[model samples]
Target: MTDPDPQPWLRLDPRMLLVHPAREVVRFLPVLVGILVAGGASGAGPWGLLGVGIPVALGLVRYLTTSYRITGGRVELRRGLVQRHLLSAAIDRVRTVDLTATLAHRVLGLATVVIGTGSVAADADEQLELDGLPREQAAALRVQLLQSGAAAADDAALPSGTPPVPVVRFAPRWLWYAPFTSGGLVAAGALIGVLSQTTELFAVRIDVTEDDLSALTGLAVLGGAVALVALVVLLAVAGYWVVNAGFSLTHDGGAWHVRRGLLTTRETSLDETRVAGVTRGEPAALRLAHGARLSAIVTGLARSGESGAVLVPPAPRDTVADAASVVLGTPAPMTAPLRAHGPEATRRRYVRALAGSAPVVLVLVGAVVAGASPALLVVAALAIGAALALAWDRARSLGHTLVEQFVVARSGSLRRRRDALATGHVIGWTFRDTWFQRRVGLVTVDATTAGGQGRITVPDVRVGDAIELADAATPGLVAPFLRLGSDA
Candidate 1:
């Protein structure tokens, strides 16, 4: 018999017309600025202002051409004005469904639904997105897409009236840890950079004479520095609180649901089976403050903000660990004692760290001796001391452990991260040996998988240990490739 007819294609919500044009205009605002500038310089009329309509036309074309449908066990999308491309993926391959509503979309009662397959390629066609759907419809669609993959599994069917069990809820106290996370500092820096670039455009001027600077007392300067730091921390805390206002993780319908954000709400769902593992991180500043963050190693998700992989923002270390254990269904592997890399790795760490910091320290010392401020001498000493501390921490953190069916690896000083990846999810193994590594009898083994960063690296381990770890992590996968003689 011939196959049944496919479902009718559905168009995006009409409200998207308004949202898309605004987005397109912002995206090309720089070009629009240039056109206006050129027109003004040439003594032209307001005709150049019509350039804004180009984005509107483009948005209209996008809305007119884009269509999607779920039919014949597949989700298909057809879009593009010139290329007219079509993309489709099997329904069972849907790994995650994300619903996002920016300020504009929320204002228009619209949400964007993103469907991720298990493909990790950067190609745009690997995933399908519906840019404008009613908020309720998008939520329903997300559930439908996620549930379709598990329709045959008995456990996928939740009992009637079963409420979503909350795994983690936003805590007001968590805001105290935000300043140490440095997310705000990064945002502040970006904002400052953008403002600086647009200063001339805005016709802004600043005049601070040397005499004005000299008039400031030492105490006033110190107070200003303290105030600036406080301001940064305060801004960071406020931003964190606002963005993560109602953050919550819940389990229902055989999937993990993450909901967060205030002005721009986001809800993401991933099939429980697609969870490969969890990563526990302690950035230097956050670690010092005894705070930690957690992210899920999802099969089809990128390890970025846009991926909705973050399960816990910077919070108390114990609190993060508790949430991680709940997600993993076992004690978190980060608590396991790792087998350290040998003395050679320690030497490498120290050599690399001092090599980078020595020149800076020397320059500072020279400046101090050449009649610069005595604080330069202190700063040089602090630099050297910081380098040594960092080197020591990096060496200490360089290790790996096998906990149950999960392979755990820890690395980095400034951004210390411990990834505990399930061995069953490992699809391949790669052993890397540079000339120096070979000389030191050390190798970096990458546990390749379709999850998280796509690979978990156990660095600076003995070649024999690396081989053994790989073989043990995924039995028989690496043993057949080994040679009996020196090549082994």
Candidate 2:
């Protein structure tokens, strides 16, 4: 009862590939008539059915040819018709077991599961895919993989788990934030572009006088712009609803459980003890709205570079704080006041930024005014001002501090990130100085580690402060590498 069931050899459901062919049926009349007119197929009525049957036939072949098994502490996959190919990954090294099911897969009650080593160090040519698993089976497999991986590879599994407690729950009011985040804007832009392109493909002929046609063209353009904006907003709002609706986070057993999505439900679980660090991203817009998003940086999980593994979807600062307390294990330092790198860094940023931007602005305003649009000058001035503000913000954000077992680094200008890395995970120190930084007696120190952002960079650090800070963050890790001229 204690051990998991041995993974049985599995094949994809033949119904999985029917997703696209189902579309052919939806447009059966048009597709069939077109095929008949073009003589694309040998026969008329039954022959057109072949268009829809091809994918299903291929799926049957794949279902018969491809096979996978998860047993004996490793996952094995094999698939190929002409040439046999086999790939295996140790269950202990598995960082992520991601399950995705589109509407089509859901209709057939199947999901595609990707088991990754959790490191992006490998190229895309390497894929760990086991497509079309039953939903319940996939979930069971994910749990088995995580539990095993956590206990052995990173000693991530906790002896016990806290009782199920809601860390973050959906708030209908936060729906307003949907338009600002990734899905909303992206969906809106895509909808606009698609509609515009579709309109372009249609042929329309009109006869009118030159002046009348001009007026009509202006009206059409204005109406089209308005329509596009409206469509974009609608799509964005709808997409936001579908992706983030019913979002919730809970602590169950030794892990954190996250669930979200509208049509295609997704649930992810991460063992708390195995988490390497925590990353908080504050986009300028989110910062303005007093909101932030948080992600877990864990030892074994493929991460979108820089963001780590996002745990908390964009939410209010208070919500983030609550989630952080549970994930990072303490009073959340996300909102804590951070130390600055000094006025010297600020001065350097301002001087360098404006120095680069001022010439372009001046040239556009003076010499280029007649040849180029005045709007260019205006844009340059605005960009220069924004860059100056961001530079100052970046300087203010520069700092590294040690709070007990945590080594925190604050950096970034526009999309500001605050990384709270566990001190025990700190592996080594990297110290580098640019020519300008050296002249100013400042250097950049990066804390290189095994997982989570790989390294945390603290720029404009005085050499003396950098060494002392490193010594504090991880006591003996950096001491041997440093030179104490007088002590030696």
Candidate 3:
């Protein structure tokens, strides 16, 4: 039987033709400020106009020229003023569609869509959106693309689907931890900023008296240091939470949709069948709280500048399995047998941890030798010991199981985790060892899958055993079973 026509298509409103006017204004504000600054400094009207007016004119032209239409069978976009351009893609050729909103857009109730064709090039076909369109309009456009059979017809649609997939909604509770957990990287960024400031400030050698140095050692200096550290930590945590807000995933009909981000909101969709694997991860601390993150390894989704894995957010354990079942069209069984590493494996892990801490140890030693305070030595030692303990715990929790059609790996100490990879998803395999590991007759196993690369160091595992596992999981042997048919 023939399928019904897909629901929800978008036709540009005449008003939408002037896309995101506020964005244009915001973008041009800096140029305007630069122009005023330059005009004051150089006392030249033409130069100031060249700097400010050009950007404002370009922004106005960009806003006025761009337009798009989402129809049952295709998406059409036209842009450019003098050098007019038009681009059209059949619903089938479009592999993925994403929606994004920055803080400004959110305030104005607007969002943008990024369309991907699975190409290696950096730019994706994009649409700059304006306000007045309902959220349902974007969701409908995604559904129509999936249901129209565009995903199934194109080889680019790695995980093809039928009908269109349902939208995943973020649970309210998830929003609470999203900011803090996801913002960890932001905190790291803030810390880096603080250090940069400190470095730059300290580098300037002002010839000053001993009283100047003493003045620098006053309460203001100490308070500033403490405040800077606290601010960095807070910013990091806030960034994490903001980035993860409104996280959701759903598969209805044949497509998969993921919506996330707070200040810069994003929505991404793909063919359900193209997904290759499902991974669940938990950091040591999150394990105690029974929290875990979900991610899918799909063929076309690119992370960084290259093809890599895309991690879904800090999902509950139950949600991960549900998302996997929907996206992959197979039940994700909990098959990874939990087993503690052998004593030798644990010892090797501890040694590896110590080796990793060597740089910190050496830095601390140098500081001590340079007449640094004893507290610095104590802090370094404590940090190193804590890191080692965490690594050992993770090693102790490591386990793997080979299933008939999939391989499951479970690892984590405080936050237990599992990853399920269909055998066909295995793209390549490698066995690695450092000189120290080889001397000890141990090796680490690395698996390259269609979605991205993942590694599990079977610390102190017999080299022969590691080699066997690598061979068994090799692409040549595993691809046949795991590889989905083109029509999938």
Clashing pairs in 1: none
The candidate with the higher lDDT, 1 or 3, is 1
**Per-residue lDDT for 208-317 in model 3, tens only?**
89887788866889898887666655675466557666666755455567767777877777666556677676766455445667677665555441212344576565
For candidate 3, what is the TM-score? Answer: 0.67
Among the numbered candidates, top TM-score falls to 1
In terms of lDDT, the poorest run of 10 residues in model 2 is 154-163
TM-score of each: 0.85, 0.82, 0.67
Clashing pairs in 2: 95-300, 118-301, 118-302, 295-311
Write one digit per residue (lDDT tens) for candidate 2, span 1-488: 22387767777665655653454456565765677666655445666567556545655666677888877778888887776778788877776556777677787888778776765546543577777788878867777776776544444343334445468888887776655566656887676587677777784344578887667776798998888766666776687688778788876535566777777766666666567778888777778878888887776554463332557888888888878877877864565566677777777778877887877777777755578776786788797887788777777777777774777778776778888878877778888888888778777888877666678788788777888888888778778867652131
Select the stronger candidate by lDDT from 2 and 3.
Answer: 2
lDDT of 1 by residue, 1-488 (tens): 11398689999999999998999999989998898899889967575767788999999999999999888778889999899879898878988888888999989999999888866666765558899999978877776677778643746455346667688889899998989977778877877788898997898988899998899889999999898788778879988987787899887777888888988888888788888988888888889999999888988666653347888888899888888888888884868789899899898889889989989988998888898998888888888888899999999989998888899999999999989999988999888888888888988889988878889888889877788888888898788878841374
Off by over 4 Å in 1: 1-3, 15-64, 80-83, 118-127, 158-162, 302-306, 361-379, 482-488
**Worst lDDT 10-window in candidate 3:** 479-488
lDDT of 2 at 63: 66
State the C-alpha lDDT per candidate.
Answer: 0.84, 0.71, 0.60
